[model samples]
Target: MFKSRRPGLVRRLWRSRVVTESDGHSGKLHRHEQRSMTHTDTAPGLTGEAGDLTEGAEREDEEQPDDDRGAMCVPEHRGSRRGQESDSRTVTCCLFGEWDFRPRSSYWAARKDGAGPCQCAPRRGVLEEDLASTAHAFLKRLKERSLDALVKAVETKGGIPGECVMVPNTELRLGAHHISPYYLLCKLFRWGDLPLSARLKPLCHCQSFGAVDSAKVCCNPHHYSRLCGPESPPPPYSLSRSDEHKPLDTGTSIGSVTSGGHRSHWCSVAYWEQRTRVGRLYPAYEPSLSIFYDLPQGTGLCLHGHHRHGGSSSSSVQQIRSKIGFGIVLSRELDGVWVYNRSQHPVFVHSPTLDPPSARGLNVKRVMPGFSLKVFDYECSSWMAEHSVKPESQEGPWDPHSVRISFAKGWGPCYSRQFITSCPCWLEVLLNNHR
Candidate 1:
């Protein structure tokens, strides 16, 4: 009985173990099959579907005649290329067309800076006015011709016996000419006006005359006293003067002051005359209002000196600052100051009067090495102190009557060492009190 029971139990245990192992193997195979199916389904969702659609379309296209395919593709390719070219052309026009919208003054400024040719369109208002004037003149001439012809015809036909000769009327219509709108637009927008260079020629000639005359009279010592006479020697060129007043005509030889006793301020251009190692003077000329004097580098001192070392010690270390180039525009009504950076490094300008406090302080303007800036409507005296010091004051009274030009940074003065012992430069605007 024990032997039979032992054999049966051993058979059952072996069968159960074999069944469990088979079940585990089957479960792993099922999971792997599911993962493979999921990967295959998701991977082909969008890209594979699109590729299949494209292939089907391509097969259909291949079935069609080659000539038909070429004909269809040629136009599509040409259209795309033309569209790209048109977009490029539009971008170019947009870039250049902006100049046309700028003010006339801006155009002149850009020209002065030696910018590229301006693609600005003509002034619409001026074009319309010109066209209207031309049309009116033409119509007037036509009317006169028609009247003359009518009279001649009547005279040939024997003048009307008693009353009047009635001539046949002819209708005049501009539309009959069949003028193109494009042609008209082109005519109206064409830049046909004189250039800035051409307009400046006359003014430049006048200024040149003044500058030459002043140079001859001031530069030659023999001619100076003779031309100026014994009563008063030609006054030294100064940034500002108050002691002596000379008429503009006598002082500058450019323009005469108003006879009505109204005070008029004039802009002066002067060259620095080095008399000795420590002595220098300015000889001025009244430049034309329409022209600008380009102050070259290493030519004249542009700033006044602020003594770092006191007394005689300051003279030993006195140095002229870096070379600078700038321009000055002066007029009774309009004035401007412009700076052109001609150096390898940046420059800074500080004007207590012209610039706002925010800009005058540590936030001074940084003029890049090759850039320029135009400040309009500048007045030299506008920056002067409001209060005046009494001449009797023991302390060195502040000279409220001075033009100060200061530069914050640059090479210490070397070229102008013979003339100036300071860093900055100043000019005095002399008020002409002579009648």
Candidate 2:
């Protein structure tokens, strides 16, 4: 079974592709793997041990058509929650995964890490009021155009993503930028940091922006996807504020982990200022919040102190502090941990689920202000932590249990802020073995 499986057998992770249905829609359903991917368990395995995974050892990309899976081309139909279908009901296929015919390979293939399928739920209060200025504006735009109803219909639909919803072909402006209404909706609802290189293509056999007879433009979030390309690497994670670099105190219970036992607390939390520890480590129990930041009300892990950069410029400190307004609230939910970004600026996250690295690189999960993302997978993390190759270090190729959140800044090859330590205000969320 994917879940409850033994770890330590590191695999190749993900490869993208699709098989045509031999029956009817064979020609329409072409493969969309773009030398790209998210995760996959059905991917082939390594010939040797994990360490032997080198460039030459990698295999060539090829499409394998599975008739059994393709036979599921018949989409089970039902009435959507918010509204009625446009013209034709959206097609949901087991092969086409979730987000509007997006291949399952584009999802987090947790089975690759000895975990279950991708059920990563969206963060709560995504469209509610109390968002940052930019986010509020986006929400207002959606509601104004009555596009929010369409998005909800797509999201809450029973089968595949609901049918396409469209808007005027003209550009929608937010602040100084002119943006595609559909692309922006996808960014808000589906992919948090939808890549700049990605362009919206209508679902296979669907019409273009205006080609649809009645629907001017297709606005369905899942109806479009980014062209296949290599994802950019995220910034490196740093632990300390001092010139002397120190590894993050990942709050590992070495004895419990090695002995295959459990920790006393649900998680151990720490607030960081550059490299300096803000205060004592906080232990979180059930029913209580795991970690929180600079909130207007009840506080837990608050961001304070200017150990380095912010200390120099009071105005800069205030500017950053303003961005940190309303901070974030992270809590342990059903089987995973969810983070709601209540701050004005975007929050960048890197956790086991977000960054499963094989040394090639990783994409740091970005949660825009007002939205949320499942930052940690508890079952997967606990299992990996107990069975990890290196139990002591939390900053391994991928630390399954701990999570890093950067406030307003993101670390990566793409951004100037390339390390977590360089980020002015950030938090280190280290989970305990509480499975």
Candidate 3:
């Protein structure tokens, strides 16, 4: 029946039937809802079928799990992604090649906290300021202990030959050799055996015939002239009656000058003596060996023993029964000192002057008992002019040129200040003066 009806009548009947069915289930649909439904119904026909769309959606859900598993397996990818995000915020600062600078929020806030990018630099500057202040205070205090005051104090309290005394609350430790103010006063003064204290007497100048007094006079000629009388006119006086009254030959040799004419005889003698004294105090060349010890020789030896009868027998017994300490054997051919530890215990040796060039900066050495160590090649000369002492003259062919050794309760180098108070032992070597 519907097919036989008119086509327009059939379409109108179908639309009326759909509208009537929708109105029976619920109220009339809103204009927006109706439009969305129309679009959904036509979208599949233009793009794909509903079954195809559902299948694609299910494949996408399954691929998400695989992607999550891959991300879990390779954590670096995730970290790189995070790093990229962080780097996007970072601003690099190009200073020097060594510096890695990044501007952080905290860096910008540093000005509020009174700090800089390099906080340690400011802290170090503060520390330096504190050190400078401390050093200034120390120097100020040191200036209070004047040399004149120190000399007066030492004169009031005489010191022993090897003893050392430190200024109270100071780092200055002065030895007996440094107890004189004259050395500090003289511009050309050098260290020598002739101490200023030995020339304190008024007559010491006259007794030494001006040789000793000239040093004092040369240092302060005007000051000494007032104390020891006017300087004697240069050697031979004029034959004139007025000049003859002056005893110009009092301190000089009579033969040094002739009565016929004036000569600088006393001045020449004085100059020679001064030069000799200086040469004796400081030699031009260094000796082959220098000996140093803390204890006296023959200290631990059994000199008066029953085995002292035969020379060979005594030597053999002494080797077996002698108490161990230290001994040295110096050979002229070797041009060095062979130091041995005679003690059963180990001994440590330290010689800044004698250390070998190949020692790789090592200065201290240890030696076992019955072992010998050679040191200081003969070719080496002393570069330390201030510490070197001239060799003393001795009457032996095999004797060393110079020897200086010190000892303490234990092993180590003995400082000059501690030499007296540290149970010190000493050894000295005297060599032929001609060398």
Candidate 4:
């Protein structure tokens, strides 16, 4: 939980991860000159995955076709506070902010078949290492064909049409066989524009489509709406609009947004990394191989970090020596965490209870930059191998602790990389701290 402390060097240290404000002087003037060169130009509206794009305004109900009129009636009435499960018709999807962290287990017996938890410290490697053969093959195929061909194949498989109805296979969820096509469809369709994907089981709304006679079904418009309604947008977010606003000038290095500016939009970010445990893996602490995915060739992806507030009270410089989490959204007030894509898209991650000791910790905080992040947790990694094929396929002695990020020029663009790899920027930050 974050609370404002007194303004001083101590405060600055806590906010170091956040982006700085422009003082409205030379820093501001210089940024004004290079603003165009820095921030990526945003595309306002383009054809997205499976549905019509809704601009700033809500879609008009009058425009619905007779066949689709019954769709989304419930979602229209439902407020934003509700979770994804509430709407039977919808599948929750997010780019960043929500992190599905593995529950750290007590050390388990190492598998004799060389089956689980490799005994290597920082045991795992990057997603790239695990899928290097697969991804490389893909690259070669892309070059053999035209970019259009590559885009088409990715679109067909990943579902880039309408609302991005299909999730692209990247290093993250690659081996996750539980992924359902209907679930993917629900994620792709816009709640406001189409029928909720038919995958939802418990048929709650048989009446909307007219239930057959003799089958007395309680038509739940509530559940029906989720099955056929407007797709919910990711969460909305706000950058701090207060006087604490610091502008990021051209050369003013990028940092976290929650540092001290006014709150902007309210979208949640979700992070999905392969779960693994310590040692007995490639470079341990690196994300599992399945986390990596080749981005839709031309598209760009960006990683936004939200930093946590140090503490409520201010202390002397010596007090500033403590370490808080890295570029992640930290809030003392709201249980919900949100992230903003540089392209202006917002994602919302649900954090029900803040008991880190309890099972209900916020999902997004799992990979905090400087907190107790274990490069390799052997117990959890073993569990992941059980689900993957050729579990021992990834061999040893590879670099696995880099953060790979891809940036491009579109709003809501999807980028996929493994978190296990140590990114240059993160390494630099670590180096600076040591210095």
Best lDDT goes to which candidate? 2
Alpha-carbon TM-score of each model against the true structure: 0.24, 0.37, 0.20, 0.17
Listed per model in order, the count of residue pairs whose N, CA or C atoms clash below 3 Å is: 12, 6, 12, 108
lDDT (Cα, tens digit) per residue for candidate 1, span 92-157 = 011112223335543222222222332222332233344444433332333333334323322222
| Poorly placed runs, candidate 4 (over 4 Å) | 1-130, 141-326, 330-336, 339-435
Per-residue lDDT tens digits of candidate 2, residues 1-435? 455211111110000111223212232222221122222212212111111222211111101121112111122222222333332322212221222223355332222332233232121122111112443344444432244334333334211334455456555554334556566565555554343334333333123421422335665554443322123212221212231111111221222223456446667777665666666677765423523334434446555442443345344334555577666666564446667654545667877665453433345655544444557766556666567533332344744578888776556543455577876567777776553
Q: What pairs collide in candidate 2?
A: 165-219, 234-412, 235-411, 235-412, 240-275, 241-275
Q: Residue 273 in candidate 4 has what lDDT? A: 19
lDDT (0-100) at residue 43 of candidate 4?
14
lDDT of 4 by residue, 233-337 (tens): 211211133211111111111222345773322222223211211112111111111111122222211222212235322232112112211122221111111
Task: Report the lDDT of model 2 for residue 384.
Answer: 64
Instruction: Candidate 3: list runs displaced more than 4 Å.
Output: 1-332, 348-352, 355-365, 382-403, 406-424, 430-435
What local lDDT does model 4 show for residue 155? 33
| Candidate that beats the other on TM-score, 2 or 4, i.e. the better one | 2
Query: Considering summed lDDT, which 10 consecutive residues are worst modelled in model 3?
Result: 266-275
Each model's Cα RMSD: 39.1, 23.2, 44.8, 29.1
Q: Specify the poorest-scoring 10-residue window by lDDT in model 1.
A: 220-229
Q: Which residue segments of model 1 deviate by more than 4 Å?
A: 1-279, 288-333, 336-348, 357-401, 406-435
- Cα lDDT computed for each candidate against the true fold: 0.25, 0.42, 0.24, 0.21
Q: What TM-score does model 3 achieve against the real structure?
A: 0.20
